[model samples]
Target chain A: MRLLHAVWTDMRFQWKHGFYLVYVLVTIIYLIILSFLPNDILSVGLPLVVFSDPSVLGLFFVGGIIMLEKMQGVLSVLVVSPLRTIEYILSKVVSLAFVSVLAAFAITGFSSYGSVSWLLLFLSTVLTSGIFTLCGIMITAGCNTVNQYIIKTVPYMLLFVLPCFSLTGFPYSDLFTVIPSVAALRLMLGAYMGIPLYEAISLVIYLTGMNYLFMRWAIRVFENKIIYQN
Target chain B: MLQIIHLKNDLRQILRDPIMAILMVVPLLLIIAFKLMVLYLVPFIQALIEFDILPYLYYVFVFVVIMCASMLGIVTGFMMIDDRDGKISELMSVTPLGRNGYLINRLLFSSVLSVFYSILGYYVLNVVELPFVTILFVSLLSSNYSIIIGLLIFTFADDKVKGLAFAKAINSLTLFAFTDLLALKWLTVLSWFFPPYWITLVVQTPHTLLVYGLALLVNFGWLFLLIRHYRKK
Candidate 1:
């Protein structure tokens, strides 16, 4: 519950940020455009955006958040807090994951066919966002400067984003079952969905476990590494 | 001659810079990955070759090509901006390495490196069935266009952060439209104005030498203009 408070606090801080709002607005305009697209166009647009969009926004904000905190000397304070490294990271995870899922859900509510399972759609987006946000934390936490972060993140970001475009390009909707982000999107489409409850639960657990491992790694790196010289 | 001196100096600095070391590795990584990914494409290509979905493949290739080029642009663009505010450019201004040499070296160095980076993307996939002439043409097109574009941004990017922002914005705007079919046809309509729009057409050809030559001329012409302005500035 305290972690929930911390998450809300961080989210409030993000919402009040002028640039954050501007970015959200830019994203909103893009979403609005997608809403108006024809079905054929939407088929590709939905999957591509779903696949790539998280990291686009996620990595930027994660880098900004970490960099800003370091610049302001808040990172040092966090290091000394009663919050364990896991807890400190949880604050970031809870906050960013909640916000990202909410945004995806809001967009889904308005733009997508929504004939799919709303609960499943929400669950899957959160699942992908959880892992992706953790990745953002890892990269942003490691790099001292924005330039290094951009360089390190850009190639992986491209790798992560481009292949999922193949999902829509290819016919086997089951492909999503193998790919994390695409699986989440499959749950989003709310159709052609096949998977036993046991299978779904196991997949979700595997993904969530990966996020936990990455978060711990990021926090450990944060705790031990002196991130900057100046 | 002063420019060659700064070129040497900048080259030394770039060699020492972590970012430069990184730029050297990126092409290699993409080449490896693209090669693996290309294995999958063989089957897809066989199916799609008969369809107008060539446009879609064209879109994907163009996206990948621009991604390669823009990565180069972002690197060269930021480093140039950083050098400008640092004592380096100001020092060159006073040295026998006159501003002309500095600008010329920037042009030559930037274009050459950008081309190298773009080829790495194809190397990973070993997507080299096209003629060597065609590959060179495409590399020049991708790299030179980015180099020219970077030169234009270098003129206005007053700081490192702004330079990075320009890099991201250019990459995003280009990649975004191709991936998102929502604005799909709208973007195709718009891509007519951009250089990457032609890359797909150039690469898909079995005897695309003439097409590549045309692209090289168009890109080199732009490069020439940007280089000229870079001098006057």
Candidate 2:
């Protein structure tokens, strides 16, 4: 019940701050522009767009949300409340995941009607959003300002996103599977090209493990850097 | 004298901030990476390409230089937003430095860094066959767009979160500069409203004095409008 209230509160904050509006506008623009491309191109481009919009967008905007809350002294207040750390973190992750799922569906459904698997898309979007949002919280844990957050996260962002670019062309390597985004990308691509049972099982396992690890890290960092420090 | 003092203080602040130090160093590192990519990766990729690689390299060079400037502008915008949140801008407004002096300090800092990065990026990319004066002139003109972006960020964003969002949105829009490589006529016409698009055009067609003039006018006009809006608010 408290988690639901927290999600509602965060959603209201996000809505009031225009994050939702910007997000919807960006999604609409991406869909409109992508609708112009050929189907084969859209097949490749759709996954990349999903990787960027929902996954990376969640990472960045959630980081900003946390930073904003920190600046507004809300985190300090929440730390003293009855709300557990897991509950607080879950609220953010779940709310962002909800938005990410809607966006991923909208983009995929609009662009590729009959070709893609809706179930795989839903799983990939939710898991990837969870991973990136947790990563964002972890990255911004010690940051007092946005500039500092950005500066610190650039290398990490590159570390995460750059590897995903390898999906574009030749020189395919299994090494990329170690990156969480690679797992997410595999799931997204699987939606289009039919997932093998082994690939599906393994990616699901890998992404789940990564999301758990990232969530644990986020909670630990939030406790030490944000809650205790404050 | 006042400008010198403000500049000195701003430089010291940048030096002291670890994030600003990272921002400074990241560009230098990227310049090195760009040089390596041109020397090593470009040749490899060029082998796969059917067309001339020189034009592609030129576009990438312009894109990198302008991107450097844009990143520097974002850094400056973050600094200004930080100051606003910390009430330092308020404090400065009460002093002889005033708000205008504060803004000028930010503008000077961002423009100087933008020009430096632009030149360094050009040198690293090593694709510009133009004369030294032309390269320098283009870099200066390109750097003004960074100033415009910095001021636009300051005017539109009220805090660090809003600043980040605004910076991302602005940078994404400015990336329309890359569309210039497509050479699509209608798209190029639409790209004119974006300042960095003019920079790409100026680099591609250096002989066109009218393009150069328009670049300067658009950037300066936006900078002025943003500043006026900020002051009014």
Candidate 3:
């Protein structure tokens, strides 16, 4: 369908814009840094590293992409095109989520050497990137420039990223898991340090629910602020 | 008069955006956060993990200030790209200000901001106490880094999106500031060519006139090279 085509086009656009090159360089740097860590630290560090960098890169990247499109007047054309708003949002999320998952896998695969659960890592990265990318789309919709988009993301990043400290054996971490970032980090940590089946299932379901809510919100924002220019 | 008008316009552009206003202060916030982390979190981590990070605090602080400078550099870079996209720079080239005047105005603005941020970051962090002269000179050397970064982004990226990517790549090179920490003999030699390494070297050994001279030389070398390349573009 058109959604798949949009995603493919978005991916090509991202590649042409050098997002993939940045990811490759960043992944290689993460690999180098992780390789230098001691084994004991590496185990604890791998998930934290992956959780912070690759999973949330979309939050930083989507703003630049949207702002650039707006500055170039591409959004005006898209407004009249047959491309649905949901497809536009999903294209960005899916394309960026693709990079995030690849980066997570490459980082975890080489650093952990197949000792971690692939399925959990995949699910964690997919949902985490999806949620953050949607959050990005929602934030960028109201902003005019990349600088505004970046600075506006600060409080939201603090909201999402700071709670993730609970993953480091903080007390009452289970209570924090309801927050999507915490849940995503828990899943990322779980990928390395095996969680109970029920915990994994619950975290996955919670994150999926959060992604749906975020996507709905993002579509509304894009339709109003970006599509309609209201 | 022209520079004043340009400055007024730039100030208006930044001040009008509430988010841009916040961006200006994020570095100060980062410094406060670093201060708090050292005061509270470091000890907590040391107690919990028994891994003390106090010894490496100097290098960490150096990296933070350099990072602050780079953030300004990237912001100025985006502004320049915005000007290009809007045809403002093109329009300015035909004015009495000239293209070179516009470029210097931007470079000077970021340099001045970087200098201010560097000095303020040092005072706020309050680690590695040094003489006022040392801090002033180090901040001066670090300012060129912002100029270099700004010109590099302007010369390299034709649009803001690519500028973001280029900014990440260029900022990663700031990692060279820690070449001494890595303690790799080969990297140490390689990092000598990087301006950040020399700025850090001056910080670690502030008394050496030779180090200060070399830092100035390396930083200005890069600044000169970037300006030439930018002019060519």
Candidate 4:
């Protein structure tokens, strides 16, 4: 299908630009650095670190990809093509989600040492990547350049990413669960330990719902700002 | 007079740039946030860690300031790369500004912003009680590291994506100042090679003229080498 071809092209383009290499290098380095920490701190910190890396990393990488395509006028061509807008958008989300899942696995596999559930890890990463990549696409929709994209997204980035730092410590608050990242972090932490079936199911439901809403919003924004504007 | 005109134009361009404006504002807001954290969250953090973290607050303040300086450097580097990509630098080469003139203008712009952020960081954090002259001296010396970062970023990064990767890598390397607090003997020994480490050292031991001089020499040496490499490229 055209969607698969587009996704493959995007993946190849990103790989050619060294995005994959930089990502792997960052993962390896982060794991190595975490290994240096004392065991007590490392155990408590691993979930938060994993949450920050693949989950939040999509925000920057996907934003960069969209901005690059916008700058090169590739999106304008896509807008005029017979390819459906949803397919084009899905290609981006799927490609970035693939990369994010790989990064999450690399980090968890190397750092957690079989302590966390692989099933939970995969679920959290897919949901987190899908949510954040759509967020990136939405944020970059109205911007034509990287600088503009950064300016518009800084406040959102701070809001989305900074609150998860609080989850690293104890005195767990019900208030933190309202943030999607905190929800993802809770799932990750639960995977490290164990989670009640209901809790795991609820969090997955919440993330899936949020992902659907964000995907809808991103598609709308892309149609209005990117497609129609061109 | 020509330099003044160039400076004015450069400042206007920065102001017009949304990304530069965001970068300028974010650091100030972070400084304010740090102040609030020290005022409110310190007690909570102390309770959590079950130790007095107050003594190490000065280093934390310096780390934040150095981070701001490095960010400015990366932004400046991106601006230069943008110029190159758009052929603006090539066009300016034939203008009255010339290439060297343009380079100095960009360096001055970034360095001055670095100094401003450093001073703002020091005054806002207010953790260390140093003489005003010492603060200014250290800030001026620290700003050179930002210039060095800018040049290195420009030399290595061909586009925005590569520029971002280099910026992250360089920042990770330069943030060794924080490692000095880990109290690891080998890390301290290794920290001596990094200019930000020297800046933190100067902050910790301001009375030591030797440490201050070494920071100056290292920062200048790196700046010289980076600029030379960039020019050759």
Pairing residues by index, what is the TM-score of model 2?
A: 0.90
The prediction achieving the highest lDDT against the true structure is 3
| lDDT by residue (tens digit), candidate 4, A179-212 | 8877887887887777898999999999988888
**Overall lDDT per candidate, in order of appearance:** 0.61, 0.79, 0.85, 0.78
> Candidate 4's error at A114, in angstroms?
6.6
* DockQ comparison, 1 vs 4, better candidate: 4
Residue lDDT tens for model 4, B119-178: 988888898787787789777866787788888777887777666667656766554676
- Interface DockQ of candidate 1: 0.16
Q: Would you estimate the TM-scores of all the predictions? A: 0.63, 0.90, 0.94, 0.88
Q: List the residue pairs that clash in candidate 2.
A: none
Global local distance difference test of model 2: 0.79
Candidate 1 backbone collisions, by pair: A116-A190, B2-B97, B3-B101, B31-B124, B32-B124, B34-B125, B35-B124, B35-B125
Interface RMSD of each: 4.7, 2.4, 1.5, 2.6
Q: Which sections of candidate 2 miss by over 4 Å? A: A28-42, A110-114, A158-178, B51-53, B182-186
The number of clashing residue pairs in model 2 is 0
Question: What tens-digit string does per-residue lDDT give for candidate 2 at A1-230?
Answer: 99999999977876676666666766766775686677777878887788777756667777778887888899889978988999999999988888788778877777744578878888888889998888889888878777788777787878877887677656766678889988898888898778897998889889989989998888998899888874
Better of 2 and 4 by lDDT: 2
Which model, 1 or 3, shows the larger DockQ? 3
Candidate 4 TM-score versus the reference: 0.88
